[model samples]
Target: MIVITALLIVVVLTLAIYLFYHHQCRLREMAFLMGEAVRNGDFTFRMPRKRMFFGERALLKTLNDMENNIGRLTAQNEVESWEKLTRVLTHEINNATTPILSICQSYLASPSIKSSPYREGIEAIHDTTSSLNIFVDSYRKMTQIQKPDPVELNLLDFVSGVACMYPSVQWHIDISSAQTLFIDTNLLRQAFINIVKNAIEAGARNIGVRWNRQLCISNDGAPIAPENARNIFVPFFTTKSHGSGIGLPLSRQVLMMQGYDLSLAQMPQIGFHVTFIVSSTCGSC
Candidate 1:
């Protein structure tokens, strides 16, 4: 009876050890597969939750985080490629259109050319050329996005400078702090100019600019919807018919490259507002 009991104990211990070793092997294999996927740029790969074992949950979580980061980087690369393609196409079209415009202008200015019965045709040609120029200019601006070099700037002074540039529009800037912020001065100015111009085009008699340091959150404590807000950072989205939709996106891109965050919000009481947040520590700026 004692011998039988001892044999039973030995068999149970052996089975437990085998099961433990098998689980460890499976965990290691999973880790290896996830690493391979990451190396291959396969961010879509996901580890099965049921397969995760003790001491492997953290590894799985890290892999998932890595996958998410890779996905974002891939998306950004795609956007940049598309932007480059659009820029090339616009440049080609502009080159063709510019000479045509100059020829039309020269013909219209000629005294003998105006005296002919084709005068009406010349006028129509001029009108069409002017319209086409405007169209091409809009498209050109949309495609050629400039990267900005950021510096420490006084928000109040910058706003005042922009306001002076456009005397016809009203500019109201409010800031809680007089602290200097690191920003791409030129790009920041351009962004402000674009937003202010949009406001003017929208017939907004009163344009308000406010700056604050806070996390962007909705009234319900959720992240704001990039879609409804027009996500100015996204390329090729414009609210205006004549707009190339590149201004805000370009501006936001510049700011982001300089390590800042830009956002837009619409409140029932406040209308539409543009906000900027600078990093606590300046990096590439």
Candidate 2:
């Protein structure tokens, strides 16, 4: 009987040891993945917290929260840096190009130079300078965006108003929870308009908006091609022939300045070909 009891005790001890090691192995694997995401500078990657031991769950959650904070701060910093750079570059570019444009125009106004070969060269210079000036001016205007003045607004009301602007398109609005968010009316309206315009340009006949822990806008439009997805939010990187390439970037900038986030979700999100997500980092603001 003593030997039998000793054998049972040994078996229980071995089982406990195996279970402890198994849990530790899973924790190491998850920690390795989280470290990889940080090293790659991809803070958007998230780790699962479910089905984990108490200690493991706490650690995973803490890591996820850190990632979220890092991503938000990084976005805000990028927007501020871009705005300062735009201000300086636009000022210098306009200063340098304006005089050349004027000189070329003044010379072209003379009839004697019309038949000269140098006339064509001067004209080309004028044309190029003019284009540069226009581009610089457009970017300069973006830097003048007003500081946001947030006010509490009904999400459904605001979004419905946007849909009303385009009666031709089929709209699906679902913010049945009727949540109120604090945001700048005009700026957010402009951002939403930009998004809707892009959807229309992409040949979308149906658009859907819903609230599921965040605001999601989906469209049955042409999906973003894989190759172009990486640069879709990059300033001045448009795939369209006449695209200014600043719509998404500007939208992100405005939202970022106001402590909000704007991102494009992976394909087929919530049964739509294209999805845009808007989430808040500022609570009660």
User: Candidate 1: which pairs clash?
Assistant: 150-184
lDDT of 1 by residue, 36-58 (tens): 86675545455665755655776
Off by over 4 Å in 1: 1-75, 102-112, 138-147, 153-181, 192-236, 241-244, 261-285
State the weakest 10-residue window (summed lDDT) of model 1.
214-223
User: Which residue pairs overlap in candidate 2's backbone?
Assistant: none
Question: Which stretches of model 2 miss by more than 4 angstroms?
Answer: 1-22, 39-41, 114-124, 266-268, 282-285
Write the residue-wise lDDT of candidate 2 on 1-285 in tens digits. Answer: 999999999999999999999978877887798788777555656688787879877877777888778867876777777778778898899889989999999999999888788999999999999989888888865588889999998999999999999987899988964688788988898888889999999999999999887889899889988678667767778878999887888998888767688877754466578988888764322
Best by TM-score: 2
Best by lDDT: 2
